[model samples]
Target: MKKILIVEDEKDLAENLRDLLEALGYVVVKVFDQAQFVLEYLKTEAVDLILMDVMIKGSMDGIKLTEEIKKSHPIPVVFITAFSDQGVLERISKGKYEGYLLKPFSLQALKSAVFLALNKHAILEKDLEGASKNSLKIRDKGYVVPVSQDDILFVEADGLYSKIVTIQKTYVLRGILKEISKNLDPKKFVRVHKSFTININQVTSLNAKELVIGEHIIPIRRGFYKSLLGLIKLN
Candidate 1:
C-alpha cells in the first residue's frame, strides 16, 4: 500500500483526511501541526506523497517546509491551501510541488488530487529505477530494446506518436508526448514546449525563445522557460 503524510493544523480536518485516505487503502500518517515533527518523521519513514497546508503551527510555513523537504527528499507534495490569491500561488509555484487544492474543495477533488499525485510519483520512481540501469527500455517491433539515456538529445510529439531523438538515431514511440516524458528522468529532461521535451545535458546554448542541442533548435514555450532554467546552472 502507498504511504501518505498529512501535515494539517486543524485536528478535525486532519482526522477527516486520514479517515478518507485510510478508507481508500492508503497508509496515512498525520502530523497535527508541527513542521519539525514532519521533517523528523520523514528521516525514519518513507511516504509516497505529502498533503501540506499553507498555514501551520510551526516556525516555517508549508511552502518553506516543502522547499526544505525537496532539498533532501524527492517526495511529491500536494498543497492544501485556503488562499488562492495570485501572490500566494506564485510563491507556491516557486517551490517544487506536484499539485495544490484551494479551500472549499470537494472530497472528490481531494481524492483525485491524491490519486494523481501518487500515480505521478510512482512514474518518477520507476523512471529513476530505469536511470540507475543507465538506459531506457523502448518497445520496437515486438521487442524491447535498451537505449542509453545519455545518447538521447530530445523528444518531440508527432501527431499521435512521440519521437525520441538520440545521437545515433531516432525512435518512434507509441505514446503521446506527456506519456513518453513520464518515463524520462525529471532531473535530466524537461518539457520546454508542448511538442518538445529536451535532455538538459545535451543543450549547447539557449536564448529567450529557443535552445540549441547541437544543430537542433528547440522552441521554448512561454510557461516552460522557468522550468528549464531551474534544471540548469547559469554563470
Candidate 2:
C-alpha cells in the first residue's frame, strides 16, 4: 500500500483528510505538529507522499518544513492551503509541489490530486531504478532510437511537439506534455519550466535563477523553482 503522511495542524481538517485518504485505500499517517518529527520518521521509514498544510501551528511553516525534509528525503508533497491568492499560488508553485488542495475542496478533487501525486512519484522512482536505459519504440516510425537513459540530457517542448534531447542527438516526437510525461521517468526528468523538462542527472548545477545542463542554461519558472531544487538536491 502507498503510505502517506498528513501534516496539518487543524484537528478537524487533519481527521477529515485522514478519513478521505483512508477511504481511497491509501494508508495515512497523521502528524499534527512539529514537522521535525516527520524528518525523523522519513529517515527510518519510507513514505510515498505527504499532504502538508501551508499554515500550521508548529514552529515551521509548510514551505520551511518541506525545505528541511527535502534536504535528506525527496518524497513528493502536495500543499493544502485555505488561501488561493495569486501571491500564495506563486509562492507554492516555486516549491514545485506535486499539486495543491484548496480549503473546502471536494472529495473528488482531493482524490484526483492524490492519484496524480502518487503516479508522478511512481514514474520518478522508475527513472531512478533504470527506466531510462530501456529502449523506447517510436510509434509506427519503425525507428528504434538507440538511446540509454543515461544519455538523456533533457526533454523540452518545441512548438506542439516534445523534443527529447540526449548527449548525442535530439528526437522530436508528436505529443503533448501530458502524453510524454507518462512515458519518461519522473525522478530523472522534471518539468521545471512550462516549456521544458530536464534530466536530473544532466543537471551540472542549479543557480538561483537558472538550471545549468552542460553549457545550456534553462530558466527555472517561478513556480517550479522549489520543486526543482528538491529534485536536484535529493537525487
Best by TM-score: 1
Candidate with maximal lDDT: 1
The lDDT values for all models are 0.87, 0.80
Q: How well does each candidate superpose onto the true structure, as a TM-score?
A: 0.57, 0.55
Candidate 1 yields a Cα-based lDDT of 0.87
lDDT of model 2 at residue 88? 75
lDDT by residue for model 1 over 1-235, one digit each (tens)? 8888999998888888898889888888656587899888888988888999999996899999999999899999999999989999999998789899988788899889998988898898899776657777888888878898889999999989999999988899989999988888887888888899999999877877999998999999876666677676543
CA deviation > 4 Å runs, candidate 1:
135-235
Model 1: how far residue 235 lies from native, Å: 37
Tens-place lDDT per residue, model 2, 193-231, is 877878888888886678889778998888777767777
Tell me the deviation in Å of residue 61 in model 2. 0.4
Q: Which 10 consecutive residues of model 1 have the lowest summed lDDT?
A: 226-235
